[model samples]
Target: MSHAHDHDPTVPREALIAIAAVLLAVMGLAGAVRLGIVPQSANPELSRAAANVAPAQQRNLRFADREDGAVLVTDADTGETVKVIGFGEGGFARATMRRMAKRRMHEGIGPLPPFTLTRWQNGALSLSDPQTGETAEIHGFGADHSATFAEMLEGARS
Candidate 1:
């Protein structure tokens, strides 16, 4: 026995039309943002904070590899090779360099792209792959280290 109030379950036409209108409005807003017709920023404080950030400073050494299996650490500002860290069978420096190379390969970047070593204004040491937009922080702003990489950076500056 069916109850008198029983009927097909469905959304009301008014609700459906309201949903469609809201969806269309959202799409139009998204399209405007995508087309650069709408300004992304709405907060002046955030814009000021972004503008206040200090630029990254050039590091002492920039590392690049050669086809013949040589890791050349050079000056960050100048392209001059400060030292050549030979690619040995296995070592920390070699392993690190290999990881960077693998990341470049994964990103489908060419060898000619700039690989930068930067010391930010806050003194954090970082190795950056500009081509892939990947950055690895080597050490904290003022961390102490006596490793070969640290020594290399120091020597490059001198």
Candidate 2:
């Protein structure tokens, strides 16, 4: 006995054409933006809020993991323990540090130079690695996460 299908398994021709047209439009827009034919809008989430302003304060900080899973933020210049983030707290700070540390390890660079945390004149905070030239704008992470780094920055001298 042979069985007959109740419905066709193929997509409509119009659907395929629509999909291709949408894809081509997206590609063209991207190309135009990349070639500077179309201006790209600044993405607040991915951009530094205070890029044009001077930093009101900057701290060279070293992050160390304690045996019990806590993270210690120390002033690199003064060698002072600035903030001790208890285990389970400071999720953002810990995650950011881990990402930078992993990159350094992959590149075979030791943790001699510490990261710089800056509070801009506009009150935006940012963390930067001088060794790798990587920067994370703290303000982009939201107020709560930004506060974590802001507190650490407050502890260090100018």
Candidate 3:
């Protein structure tokens, strides 16, 4: 037989199966994202999902406001600030004041974990738990002056 006549006409079935598997995985993940099942930075709003279910009086605790490009959201009943994060800069990031809280939690700062916070009209800060929906009292100054950031997941019951 001539050398050119020896070429195989069929591709291995293994290669075709592998390509199909990869495509399926990508599509499955995309579906989960659209259904609000997968959490990503692009979906920081996912945290809000956990914030729902507050009593009627506490329902107001969701997204509060958008100052400049930053968003103010937190649990309402306890008045703990959930996320004083930005929605405009690089998608979203912790606000300067909130970042200060992380850095100053120990230097005359407020309690760590089990503490969510909110700013009142009188300028007083209220602390809350992301899990229990309960709140504690706190002073707003130094690191405590920072926006309410949950110290840890242990703070949030869920």
Candidate 4:
């Protein structure tokens, strides 16, 4: 005589509950990070590099875009026109003006007054909107293409 036995493999109820709890905790943590409730860590090297960077040599360039599609690059100290970047002109200044307009529209803001671009003593290039009192830092100040705007500003002073 022979007896046959059958068995089924199954996870314990406790294990299933534990797994669900872990998943929920992970999701909650992710949501917190996405909502900026938890601040992210910064790279130490980048922070050091930023701190050690030299100040910008030219720090007086300011720019303003008019309602009539004209861009005026000026000196911040003297308020003199550095250059007149005309509409449809293919240049960095014009491109920057267009970008500013697009950003304003995206933010659901109305007409924007002139903005000022200044290179700070700490080598930070900033663009400030007078209307909204908003300032944005430009990271690509010393790049080759950015030389056009810098050159224009320098030329205007002379």
- The candidate scoring highest on TM-score is 2
RMSD of 2: 5.1
Tell me the number of clashing residue pairs for each predicted model.
0, 0, 6, 0
Tens digit per residue, CA lDDT, model 1, 1-158: 77998987999999999999999999999899888898666433244357674434445445676798888777656677767876673266566656877898888875665666655455445666777766655663233331445555553332
Q: Which regions of candidate 2 deviate over 4 angstroms?
A: 1-16, 23-51
The numbered model that scores best in lDDT is: 2
Ranking by lDDT: 2, 1, 4, 3
lDDT of 3 by residue, 1-158 (tens): 56977877887899889999999999999988888798555422233346552321112334433657666655544667655555653231244334434444445545333334444333333444454444433333344433333231123332
Overall local distance difference test of candidate 4 = 0.60
Question: Scored by CA lDDT, what does every candidate get?
Answer: 0.62, 0.84, 0.46, 0.60
Model 3 / residue 107 / CA error / Å: 50
| Shift of residue 138 alpha carbon in model 3, Å | 39
lDDT score, candidate 4, position 96:
63
State model 1's lDDT.
0.62
**1 versus 3: better lDDT goes to:** 1
Give a tens-digit lDDT track for model 4, residues 19-133: 9999999999888888889754553324536777533444355556778777777766666777877776736556665677677778776552445565444544556566555
Instruction: Score residue 33 of candidate 1 by CA lDDT.
Output: 84
Every model: Cα RMSD to truth: 9.5, 5.1, 15.3, 9.1
